[model samples]
Target chain A: MQSQSDNEYGIQVYNASINPAPRCPCVLLLDTSHSMSGEPIAELNEGVKTYFEEIRQDDFSRFSVETAVIAFGASDQGVSLVMPFTSCARVEEVQPPRFKAGGLTPMGQALERGLDLLKKRKREYRAKGIAYYQPWMVLMTDGAPTDQWREAAQNVQNEARNRKLVFLGVGVGPYVDMPTLTEICPDNRPPKRLQGLRFCQFFEWLSQSMAAVSRSSVGEQSVRLPNIDGWACVEA
Target chain B: MGKVIYSFGRFFGQAIGHVKAHCPAPGKDRPWCDQATADQMRGARSKTRSEPQLVFDRNGIERRLGPLMAKGGEGKVYPLADHQDVLVKIYHVRARNGDRLQTKLEAMRQMRPMLNSPLFGWPRLLVFDEAGTWRGYAMRRLAGVQMQTLCQPQLIAERLPHWSRREILKCARSFVSLVGKAHRNQVIIGDINPGNLLVDPQTCEVRGIDCDSYQIAGTTGLHTCPVGVPMLMAPELLGRDYSRVRRTFEQELFSVAIMLFRMFMLGLHPYSRTYGEDPVANLKSGHCAFGLGAGCRLPRGPWYKIWSHLPFRLKDLFIRTFRDGHGDPAARTLLEEWNDALDEYLERLNKGWFDPHLVPSAPKSSHYRGSDSGRRKGTASQGSRLFRKNA
Candidate 1:
């Protein structure tokens, strides 16, 4: 355990109060439903790796980037750290943990899990006296969830709408209702489509954006975002 | 009062050794002189010393002038000499807290690495002292008049009754270039009001001043952060949290747009029309100038009339930059737009449309002497209280 002033662990005590590192934590909630079994899965995995690789190359994203991966459909594919944000040098240092595809798409469970993780991290930050910006939860799906997702989706939507989390949803392939995804993300609109093989592009943006928020000295604003042009296509 | 008096006493204490070694007092031993009386005597001797007498002074520097100017919020600005003409800014520590001082000083220091010849002429910092109880610094001084005085209707009529279109645009471009330089360097001068900018009469050059609240990138390769005055701060910087990074080039571009709007429209803020009953409350409520009836005149029906005279896209971008730049920092104009608009504006200005010198204002030479020999009360307390040397 590092001392509060180490700044890496987000604990920063000043004038008798803990001044925590103001970092933004981000999670990529992916849908590996049965429909996404073959090429989509392979592309998604490659895209995920590419996301890590691309994010580390950015000037601002290196130290501030943290990642969590939660994939639905595969019972074994529980939410786990694709790459934990620490004082790590490169994203590749942490191997991209593999997620399988088998069960029904339980997006609610995945989203709930992702939110829980973010909440836990936030609590940790608060305990350590590190300040943090709004955490981002990005949901990507190919099909609708099999579980009673409305309640979970509504909960997620409420949190996102209230800005409790910076929520973004991306609909990929076909069968996933874009309008439904949009409804889930009322505050920032709904899931944008992964235009072409643009998962890399979206993740690249995510990494850079998170890094921008992270690398900032604990009290900076979350502005100057990367242009949304090259990433996901907004469903007009 | 006690702290000031204590600090004043300390100021003399530090200077005593330097004073004795370099310039001896007029009367060595005046036993009848009281402590206050002795302070007055020492203060006079410290002000004016022969060249050789000043050489051996600490670090070969000498006092150039006593406290000459004081702004309402900012502290006093004094002219000093240390092989160069410099302005010493002494902040009233009591008025500003430690965190604020730390924030301001750190932001200023972050810009140090990127300091080159700024287009609007940035004064280089010579020293930054937050050690002990007080905080202050010495910086290069620019030869200029306050922009606040220049555009005043009364001052304009008396100073230069007829400013040509070309001179006005050239001066406008000069101001833009300076702002452009700051953006390029990843700095945002949050206080972009006219009162904070200085203009040189001889060359019609502009320089940014009162930079204690400016923001820049952290020195250790951290993200670009936000800093500076909240009033002139971009919406994003002021919203949600205080940023330690510089506002994006896009946001800076928006600031440039607003600055130009003020310059061209005769110093009117876009939202000034609604600023009647309570401006502060409106600002807090996120109400900016865009579509309000009177304040919108510049960019709306009448203003767009003038804007239409300019190139299509450039005018559109200018309006969009400010309009979109209104409530959200995220939606501001990018650097590409600013650079393009600036290029267009410069080309237009260079075509003999405006005369910068003709802008209504007193020529700097009339009121501002490069060297103002104001009769300073030569007292030890005054001299000591004037500037705090960096440790």
Candidate 2:
């Protein structure tokens, strides 16, 4: 026994109820080249899972943290968008895809793809009038790029300098070139070297940092990041 | 019924057998009597290791825990076996230091007499583990949905469609009364948000939960409520280190004003606009869409139309709270003033100034289609102006 107006109002009310919340988008740019095979790949998988679990537990982050995982050197395409941007709640429901390291490192292609996806997502947010934090691109690798990477590094530097995105580069194991990571990351902050295969601790810090960002008012000058002494050492 | 009688003797250890004789039949006036008896029997028989349990002592009173009802960032809430009216909250093992929590709980117990009113679920019993580790405390278990469910206007509209404007007004009045009672007791509800209040839809009764977190005025050396929800926090507290700051009554009043605005406006936050994407930023910048001659006004839609139906006195208070008092915490509306204004609004509604159902007018044009373009155009012009002013 509902009238036309009542039905229309119901739809409007429903739309209002499901209004878009402010979003904190994070892109995980992972390297799955042959060097990451064994313990490194296993630990990285566990870390990603832990990251999702931690984000899901936070009430605000579950709705606000939109995550996308893109892996390089894991597929025939050189780089693969393993998971598109999804809320932490949805990420928790799906079993994270297992990474098998076999191909050559295509870090530049992966970085470019991650930046492209983040920019596209931001545009969608603007079109839909959704509020967002500066998107985060976390690049973790253990080896040098097999493909050309100067342009990708320059793109990251430009975005980071403009305060358009937060680019945190992490070099894993002794084989990683720390100097390259510094060049790729923003000038204000240098890249950090992961201690041992401590991917779990690293992701835990990332999750906590994202939670802090999502908690603050959007468009604030800077979010106070939690202490990162647990899993990282400044790359010398 | 016979099983309950037989088990009652074994459960209460014969002392309460005589009381069982006076127990009424099922579905009678004293239904809780049967429930209590059943609970005792269940307690005596069940010794399952899988079921989590905690034991705690308040003064000399010992309370046995039951199944967990809910869990949060701080602790787990379990119903008391013998007492149906009370529930025990056991804090997580890593919550602060044991001695500090003990001191805080003891202070809460001292404040019990003033907080015994029905509006509060104040801490009544201090709980501990087997090794005397200070865990958490017990308080009254409020039976109802969280006020958060009704914080938004759409939920209220959909859930309580039959409700008139009078009923909604009554709900707001109940909320104000609860806050007034706490203030009278000299307790600052540090984290005042919809999640912390429980509302019984049928009776319009509002009860404040998480009383353990309330800042007791003069409890020296006790751990205070250190944090607040960002959305509910006043502008001054937004970017500061909250753990170091002691929240005052004036700061709490700011949150109260925001809550009242939300309740009266259906779920629309005074700072919320279709164009403005960040609510926290809007609050900090004092961009109240409903304020008079404001640059960023509420989108011209159903919500704006509904605003016209509000009583002028209440509207004026909202403007004062969000606009004039936006920068200064002391300028916000006081609890007593809110109580007075809401009471007057209720009186006028009773006198039939307008029908509540008639106030929520359906949009003439589809808001989704028509308002979006207009809102974008408005945002392009007004948004820049507001940004410049704020800067």
Candidate 3:
């Protein structure tokens, strides 16, 4: 019998049995660039690790969750493939993959690369006859793109308008313009500010939301996302 | 009720909902959504279009091969094509999830001869295609039945009892040479029981099979299977301890010992299975099921008592391998007794001293002839013989 809760997540992880539907693929476009050095970057990096570890601990999330991190700091030229989540054969194999710091925040390149990775993973899921939800791109940045970023922002808006992907813009630290970020979304209030080193908390919420979405059968959606309280207040 | 006060909670909730409904703040959206989505969609479409086609039917493979023409693990062997009998091995879906690609790579890399000599009867790898979704490999099917069935003591006693002991030695010597060949090629035939070795009854030729479990040098790879035959497996291998790789040569020799024991003693698996309800359960218990049989009761001088006849240094090798290979696979090694015994046996067989009890053999039938231009000339003899034998 399919319980309503079980049906909510696109994946079911019970007794180490992972049932994954090709519902959605999510990538975290992290700013491991030079400007995010010291406390800001450490917290951000910690947040990224928390996202991976927390997601793996969840029974349902562990199955369907295929996470990729695109770091765009030191190698500012373009986004490089960090890890393909599909090869994590077992829950024990899923560890918080490490990343090094020191480079220009190439947010544009990271966005471009993250998208490609999600697409590749999604193709694999479909090939295996699994279903998927809308793919997601969670962009975490602290400053304006040192490289050309306007075009990348436009790409985000277009994807959001088309409902091709669910774009979440998170601006942490100082110098993040809310209006410019929200312009990346067709809908209003698209950009949100990071309350503190609470990026980890936000990732936890994101992971839970994804898990909830995957548990449900095809077409069923998740409502009542956890309250974005101290971790992240809705951007005014 | 005042309208402002009454609707305050609903108004605040709706406000928060409206805010949550929109996108979060964003500075770099250009490629994030548009370029990213486009790149992903393109990559996805290309991969989906380029999926590999299956050559053999997944379900039909096991049906043809059946439950291991002999005892084996969960995966079944299937014939891929009749062109000189190409066999494709399909790993069970459950087993497929293991580190198959890693295992295959290790198998290919480690099959090197440390001393750089010729291997006796090792099969050449034909194709290893991991790109295809389902894990499979195609290898040329070697000639002969599993040594276990072919060399059964009862069957040998019935069919070849009149045969001299010297003739048996030559057969055993050939097996030693085969192991030597495998070691020379850098392949550790991880499992060396009679069940894995195959031999042509008419030609007395032998070849090793089931190379998937074979590991490369430096790797602590051990063959995992549904139990029942742990007696033949080195103790360290059974436990899968990496320290056993240190006794690489000795461990290999231990396998040869077990193989020799099965052949010379006439089909007694050095250790027996518990005849348990579940064979896998018994194997996991890692203890010999049946007691050592009568053939091993011989005293000194006879090679059956070769352990005692062995030199102090060599005797210890056999003792360790015979004793520890199963539970402590690292402590065992291939003993020197095998080469010495094999050499002596082979020498006696070639001298005509081994042929006395047999009647003069009848002339073999003339082989069928065909146009020699295109078809493999010798393959037909081997292929047709196997097909007819299997059929």
Candidate 4:
């Protein structure tokens, strides 16, 4: 039988053969407003599915990456944490929720939900004394937020600026409020405008980038990410 | 991940002779070459060289390209319209510096040792655009389930359900031998990773792909492997420029060790079990956790059990390499040492000293009873593939 040995921190990591290896958690905060009901939602679902499929094929990404998905702009007028953080190793069991676009774009609430989930996940990591990479939040939206976002924006600034998180804001379509998205992002990194409805390329880049980062061993020096030019368009 | 595109110089180097001239279309006169260009068919001057539909092989056989098959950061790969078995890898035309890419390809083309081997996806046909600009080359397309699937537990259990310790070990040994063949030819698979290899599920025969990235020593000069992943990089090559450094065999062996470790230990990076820190840091510090064993903070998992179940000598080989080899290059385990250890392990397996269980969920570690099996003296260490009747 698999037995637990006392960890250096002396915490009881209660499990057998299920010891969590170092993890890299990333939360994808997506916009599913009513305007995205048709082609946009279909394309977005395909893209998210492609991301899972690509990460499933990669050994490094398969073993280490943990993904949670959160959606905003549902009928409830609040954010829905669609999927909690699950190991990519359990890829077959984990499915990207079939998102149906409905109501107000509560961008602020989604960011808060993503941040809260990340915080809780990090606590679990620390409790087990498990090593982890800085968390990543990829926020994609096609339209402007309907609610107040100043607190979420400030939290993103602090988390990203303090190096606790790698937050990226992606403007999905022409209707996006670039200024608000920029305000939410850190100063060094600006929100990237997604070209057309190329959600497939964006998620491929995300999965490939995560694979590289999770495989990377050092804290200093940034890991080289896949080129963003494929999906991100130049801002006018 | 910079986008690397080679510039096309006006001049074209002399093409090497083709191994076989593919007479693609029997009745059609030279397919791409004999067919009048759209401009010729139209009887008008071409529009800025137009799209290069025709590419000339070394034997001057002009071939037509089919629809694009696959694309990557560097370039796109296409298959010959008539010759379905042959695929061509063409670089993107962002051409900044063409000479280096040309020189590297030209040099590699001259290395004939890789020509007949199915083990490597070596560039076989030198393909040039109609303008005589070196675009890319063609190779026999290899078909197999990518080794990445074989490495992961969940995937392997589903894909190769019949795989056990014997199959995994046999595959690993075959991979080592293939790399040995490449090394003998002075070719170093500079970016060694599971992603770059393909495995035949039936025979567990591993085939290495992405030959363009190989570090090959040409008759003219050394064509250095320019790019590498950090996880596969050797210790001394940590901060060094991959383009400038000439990788030694000993250094290359370290990466071999890493890949071997992943294959044997269910895809765990040697440094991964580091008590909540950067795993690669152990590579730099020369303080690998495996050597410490019971003293180290090895979490309760299948990996720990595998380590515990590993034969003592094999564990020592890994320890010496990961821990001691960090400081001294010579301390790293060599291919022959691996062969020896594997030979012993095979014997132990054959004699039923241990169970032939290799899955991650392999039960708690009491299988190693090699002490009772007793050591076989003077067993010829040449690639031991023999298995006992009962095993």
**How high is each candidate's TM-score?**
0.40, 0.65, 0.35, 0.76
> How would the candidate models be sorted by TM-score, starting from the highest?
4, 2, 1, 3
In DockQ, how does model 4 score against the reference complex? Answer: 0.18
Residue pair clashes in candidate 2 = B153-B266, B153-B267
What DockQ results do all the predictions give, each relative to the true complex? 0.01, 0.14, 0.01, 0.18
- In candidate 4, which residue ranges exceed 4 Å CA deviation? A1-24, A32-65, A73-77, A87-92, A98-106, A122-135, A142-151, A158-164, A172-176, A193-234, B1-53, B94-97, B293-295, B360-391
Model 3 scores a C-alpha lDDT of 0.48
Candidate 2, backbone clash total: 2
How far out, in Å, is residue A60 in model 4?
A: 6.9
lDDT of 3 by residue, A53-116 (tens): 7566543455556777677775545466666654222556666656666777677777767766
Q: What lDDT score is found at residue B42 in candidate 2? A: 25
Task: Flag the better candidate by DockQ, 2 or 4.
Answer: 4
> How much is A152 displaced in model 2, in angstroms?
4.8
Q: TM-score, chain B only, every model?
A: 0.58, 0.76, 0.51, 0.77
lDDT of 4 by residue, A1-236 (tens): 21232211111222313433457899999899898899999999999998888776665677678899998987775688888887667555767777999898999989988999999987766444355788899999998989889999999999999988999999977788999999999999999998999999899889878877765654535776767888999766
Q: Output the TM-score of candidate 1.
A: 0.40
- Please give the TM-score of chain B in predicted model 1: 0.58
- The deviation in Å at residue B124 for candidate 1 is 4.9
Per-model fnat list: 0.00, 0.13, 0.00, 0.13
Least lDDT summed over 10 consecutive residues: which range in candidate 1 chain B?
B49-58
